[model samples]
Each structure stands twice: as C-alpha cells, then as structure tokens.
Target: MAHASTAAAEDSCPLLLGKNKLPRHREADTSEGRVVERIADFQGPGGIIDLVYSAVFTRGIEKVKQECLLEAGELPLVPRNFDCWLCSTELLSLLMRGSALGNVGAHTAEGSPNTTWDGHNTIGLLSKSEKDKGVPIADALKNPLTPVWILHGGDHFTVAWCSAATPAEPGSKFLLHHWNGLPPGGPRLADLEITAIKGAISHGTSPSKFYKPEPGEIEEVVQADPDDKTDFPGQYRKWRYEVMLAFDRPDLQGEQRPVDALPEPKFQQEDPRYQRPGAWRCCLCYDRRFKTMDFSLVPADSPDWCQKCSRSRKECGWSLWIPFAELPPKRQAWCMSQYAKKIEPLLWTKWPEAEILEVSGRELPDC
Candidate 1:
C-alpha cells in the first residue's frame, strides 16, 4: 500500500526536466500565469560583475529578478556584451531610483536598515565585493555606468543579476547577455601584426625582415608600429593567434555599494593655490589627464598637452598603455613597478614576432 501511494505521488509530481529543481515544500508554481519555472539560478559572488556564459529572466514577488548560471556551458542564444550590461543596468536602476524596499545592504550607519550608499543611493556604479565593504550583491550589477563593469573571457561576455532578500534563484526580466564585436570574438595577435604592417606602409616605410618575410621578400630598415599593415590583403599572410586570458571572476558579477562606503568626493571651490588654467578635463571625473594648458603662457590655439587616463586604453607593448583598469589590484601595482613597467613595453616591441604570453587572471563565467 505504501509503495503504491509513493508511486502515485511520484507520478503526480511535476516532470523533472530542467537543471533547477527547488527543494520539496517550496511549492514552486510552474503553471502559466503563475510563477514560471526558471531553468536555473544565479550562483556566484554578489558584488562583483560576473561574466556569464548564459542567462535568463522572469518576474518575482515585488520586482523582477534574473536567474543566471555562472558555470553552465550551453545557454540560451543571445548577444554576449549587451545582454550582460542591460541586466546590470536594469537591476541597479531599480535599486537606486525605485522605491522598492528590502535588505540589499547589511545595515545603515545609524543602525537602521539601509540599502545603498549613505545619503545618496544612485551616485555610483557597481563595486566589486572584494573591493567594497558591506554592499549588497544586487546593487553592483544593476548600474554599470559608474563602475563600467565588463565581462570579458571565453567566446562571449555577459552580465548577471542578484537579489539580497531572496537568496534563491532569480526570476525576472532583468537577465540579458547581448554580444558585441565579432561573434567569433575580437582581433587576434596576427590581426594586430597586420594592422602594424598597414601602419608602416601608411608611414611610407618599406617592409623590413622584422617578422618572417615571404619566400620572395626584400628586407629594408624602417620605423613602424607593429599593429599596422601595408596591404590589407597581405594581412592574411601572417599567422594569427587568439590570446584569451582570464578576466574577472567566474562567480562574481558587480558590487552593490561604494568601495569606501563614504560619499563620493566633491570639489568645493577651485583652489587658487594650485590653479591650472586652460586645461580640458574628462567629462566624467574631470581628471587633469586629458589636456593641461596655460592660456597665460601659451596661445589658446597652440598645441596643448593633453594626457588621457591610461585606464581607458587597451593594453599593448609599444603603446605602453598598460592602465590599472585592465589589471587587477596586485598586478596593477606590480605592473607599475619600475622594472616591470620599464620592460613591458620593450617586450612588446622587440618581440613583436614572438608569440603572445598568456597571463593568468581571474576566470569569469563564459558568456
């Protein structure tokens, strides 16, 4: 009798098909119009922006949420970059601008429950948990504008969503993972070489024997960038190698709060003591790197010294554009060391023909 009843109960239970199956007694509704059954759940660090291999979305109780599988290999087809960034923005905007209440943050400074940066909840972007203090996991992924979190690794990049109140699987429309660039991925090392060759030609320099020349090739000394190419068609002659290094964390997405937990700094007034005149500053931070000028000394129309924030550029050897944005904290410091910084650009230039050396970084989800 007990065996018959057990068999009947098993038959009555919903068919087990997808990867995610909640524990018994949770009573998840799978019927249409009810809570739709999500394929999987978001499992990873809360505050860091994770590079998802794939993702999905559904509605939750009060607000929408997302369900992401950080490690799942096969995922619903979607553009890699856009999907992730959209998900991040949606969730963050809700937390920052919306009136939704919950325990996104651990506690407010006054000991009351607070969900965001003190006083201002929407001033910044996502902060990685390892770098911030007591920020909820959901906030980091919602708004990537302030943090500009990127998911880079594998074939596709992605962004994820999280909810602090419900530690369970996400179920909302906030999940997305759109791909950008080439579906096959970005330029290869050989592609960069061809770019160098083209640049050399544009500079009116004959091809040199720096890289292995063809069977019937002539050698000539010339100054040229390694990424340019003379003949666009000849670019295919060079062997291309894809250099995919680990970036960000597989289980991390974006940070929910400011790293310092302090209000973002505000400049009260221009200090006359250290006054700088006629300098073009970055629109965002107004960092003094773009172009510093002195109208008092130099003509306004004269060439101005504009320094860009190294963080914005891609890292390359001759470019010497190794910015902290591309590297982790420890590696960033180490890269800036006198020895490493001095040698890195040289290594890139002298060894243009050499294969790219793979650097190990935090492995992120494969979106």
Candidate 2:
C-alpha cells in the first residue's frame, strides 16, 4: 500500500498505487461544496469508510424512485420497505446523471455524446465470450485519461482511474479507489479485468438483469446472522457483474483532481484524548497499554493530574500525575517507541509507507 493518509483506507488491504507520490497532508477545499466536504478526509471513528458508498447509494436510490414516480405517475411504496441494493446499472445511471448535473465529475472521450449508455457495460457470469467482449472496456481502462466505476455483484463497489503515465511504465497507469477495505491481495483491478473478459466471452450479448431483492425477503435479510457464512437470504449467488463508466470529457464538473490534497483527518485534530504529535499511555495501570494513547490535551497552564489514573487510584494505588507537556524527553521517547512497536504489524500489513512515529505516537517535545 502507498500510505494510509493519502487516500481513504477503507479496508486493511492497499487499494491504489499512484505513479506520483501523494502528499502527506492537505487542507480541505471548501469552495467545491458539500460533497467535497463530506468525503475529502479519512477519519476513523467508525473503523470503516462508508461515506462514499452511502452518498452514492442514497443518490442512486433516489434516482430510481424519481424515475419510477415519473413513469408510473404513482411510486410503488412496497419496494421502499426493504433495504435497497443498487445494481451496476442503477449506479452507472446515477453517475451519468450526476455528471450531467455538475454534481459528479468524469472523463469522456471527445466527440462522444454529452451522455451515452457506453459509460456502462456489464459482464455476466465470467463466460469465455464475455471475456472476449470485455477486451475493449479493459483496454480503455488502461488509458490514464479514462476513469471507470467497477461494481462487483458480491455487494461491493470501487473506482479505477489512470495516473499520469510515468517514464518507466507509460502504457499501464491504472489506480483504483475503493471505499470498503480490500481483502489480502489488495485492489483486484487485474482480476476484474480478467473476469470481465471471460464474462463477456461467455455471455455474448445475452439478455441479463441485475438482481433485486423482493419485499418479502426483507425480513429474512434484516434478521439473517451476520456470521452465518452463507449468502444472505435474498443475495444473488451465481452471477457476477462488472460495470465500467468512462470519463471521456475533461470538462465534467466534479472533484476530478487526484486525491492528494484532502484535509487532515478529523480524528487527529478533534479527538480529545491522544492529540496528534505525541504517543501516550496510561502509566498508572501496568496492564493499560495504548497502541495510540487515549487522553485529552490540557492547556499548558492547567494543573498536572492524570484524571484516568485518579479515577481508579483506590483500586490500583497508582497516580500518573505527569501532564503531557511536562513529561521528560526520555519518557516521551519511550512512549513513542512503545507505540511504534505496537503499530509495526499494521504498517507492514496495510500501510507500508506510513511514517511510523508520526502516525502512532507524538512528534513534539514536552513543553
């Protein structure tokens, strides 16, 4: 993986590898509007990056509902009762519409229609013919100018965009972005490419439909055991579909820039405990170790008192009264070293380029 701070780290596996180095810190661009505000930074209170998915999913659902209302004059309320899962078709449709409305940005080829169904193509069931037919889509994605949205039938979505071709590898500059974390192998763009081609070769223009859950299946879906290891009650099992959305036009209105300049994550700045620039741990409780310490920053003039240690002093008979700023440099270093050791596995597993000391503990000297 490139680094955790550069792009949203949705899952444990690394997603994209850009040709250009991503900036370590960036300020939020407030002028671009709320969409930018909503997802420009990667904060981790929830441990999952779902803002992009939530935004796209909600917009797709609303678009479907609006189209239904317009065509039928009365919307069927029954379908809304179940949790909605968007098929590749619906997501592509929403992306196209969002681009047109200037809410989403995409690349498009010159002379291509202002809008075209060509933005989306689905490969069904990884058949031989399907693979052959998907060759063009796969080829188009190789160009850095092309941006495509990939949807996996197994309840996942991700995007791929090309980075500026480098001198070393000019022809293949694809980079992927996924909101959800990836499995062990990292972003599977190559796997998707192979699957797309196989699916196209096998299915060859056959009539197909993205699966939709029935209203009756909603209860079972809601009540299903998350750990059951089986497909959810209404989930589709046999078929896998991949949708590709092309970014042909350079004039599209959206956040088309590379994700280098996102604002600092909120957790680093706002988390009351464990302020940035330092790594801390509860000194009183021998067993209380912190990979990243959890404690609020007190003003420089505030009295030195370890509230956490004080709260349980009767039980542990220890009081860690040293404030963060007053800690001896040697002690501060010790804390940071401990934090680095604790986070070593994560760095090796998910964030290889992580500045271990900067991310895990503190970087500043005690006042």
CA RMSD per model (angstroms): 21.9, 26.5
Total backbone collisions for each predicted model: 51, 32
Q: How big is the positional error of residue 315 in model 2, measured in Å on the Cα after superposition?
A: 89
lDDT of each: 0.26, 0.27
TM-score for each predicted model, relative to the true structure: 0.21, 0.24
Q: State the lDDT at 240 in candidate 1.
A: 20
Worst 10 residues of 2 by lDDT: 193-202
Error of 2 at 362 (Å): 36
The segments of candidate 2 whose C-alpha lies over 4 angstroms from its true place after superposition are 1-64, 68-88, 92-129, 132-144, 147-180, 184-367
- In model 2, the Cα lDDT at residue 328 comes to 33
Candidate 2, residues 250-324: lDDT per residue as tens digits? 443444324464321111112234232222222233333353364343323323434555643233322122222
lDDT of 1: 0.26
Which candidate leads the pack in TM-score? 2
Q: In model 2, how large is the Cα lDDT of residue 172?
A: 26
**Cα lDDT tens digits for candidate 1, 148-172:** 2233222233332222221112221
